[model samples]
Target: MNSHPLFSLVAGLLSTLLMVSCAGSKSYPPLATVPEVNVQRYAGHWYEQFRLPNSFQKDGASAEAQYTLLPDQSLRVVNTETRADGRQKTATGRATAVSGSSNARLRVKFEGLASLAPAAEEGNYWILQLAPDYSAALVGTPDRNYLWLLSRQANLPDSTRQKYADEARRLGFNTTRLLYRPR
Candidate 1:
């Protein structure tokens, strides 16, 4: 009947609208990293100010990360966090600069797997922003799915924290979801 054709048209239009909305939600391209990173100045302990929710650090509190330069020119990364239950957890990993990335992009691999073979894949760690004094840094993945605001001290000034959050917003992240780490 005529109703059959009308229903088909409506369904087609609805599908097209759904597709367009989905595309709009992913408007931003992968994030960009700073042009260069001075590895020496970047190496040190940084306390987490805030971060996007991640399964690995679910319910983590007082999270912190330490980066040390290794003899091989690689980086040793240590991440420590306290759980809500007052238990401390730590993870150690190795990071190497992505060749030809101006030391701004790094590939990191954490130890531990079902087999002894080395990890075939590495996670992308990009330095998005770094304060001139190297006292504060903003790091995230190219996908913009992960973000962290870190500072040399346990507590960063409120103004500095807001500035970083604004930067993240400009970078297309959902800043409202950023969770603060315990002081």
Candidate 2:
């Protein structure tokens, strides 16, 4: 019988790859959000202090988000960013508060082709941490793949940034993965 060594090697590699993938996928406890969110008080302009790397927001020097309360109680989300080339990019979206979540969870849908990605469609926009004064916030997805630190002020204090990093770490996020624009 003629045995092909290449076939066995390929099968072994595939097995190893599958095992590694399965072992690397770690499932955590259900992501928790603050008890409640006052969408009315949350409405206003916010500066993106830090975020996990994502494809759509690449090349941004600075980013800001504005929220307007709609008549239907949904939120009008307008995100504007200054790219490294000095041009500005803006996107508009709608955020409908998830029912019975005390206005905490929101299903956000950004308009345009960017919405086509199934990976981005899973809307958790979970508010993991919110400042009592609403001055700073830590937002992340349940899957732990996305995270953002925001502040109402353009320049957030160093202490708050540290708090964000600590909280994110405690929440099963790798703080080292967070990206921030230099102020």
Largest TM-score belongs to which candidate?
A: 2
Tens digits of per-residue lDDT for model 2, 12-53:
786587567656776567789999998888899999999988
Instruction: Count clashing residue pairs per candidate.
Output: 0, 0
- Candidate 2 global CA lDDT score: 0.82
Span of 10 residues, lowest total lDDT, candidate 2: 115-124
Give the per-residue Cα lDDT of candidate 2 at 130. 92
| lDDT of model 2 at position 7 | 59
In model 2, residue pairs whose N, Cα or C atoms come closer than 3 Å (at least 3 residues apart or on different chains), thus clashing, are none
Stretches of candidate 1 off by over 4 Å are 1-24, 114-123
In the predicted model 1, the residue pairs found to clash are none
lDDT of 2 at 165: 86
Q: Which stretches of candidate 2 lie over 4 Å from their true place?
A: 1-23, 118-122
The true-versus-predicted C-alpha distance at residue 147 of model 2, in Å, is 0.5
Q: Candidate 1 at 182: error in angstroms?
A: 1.9
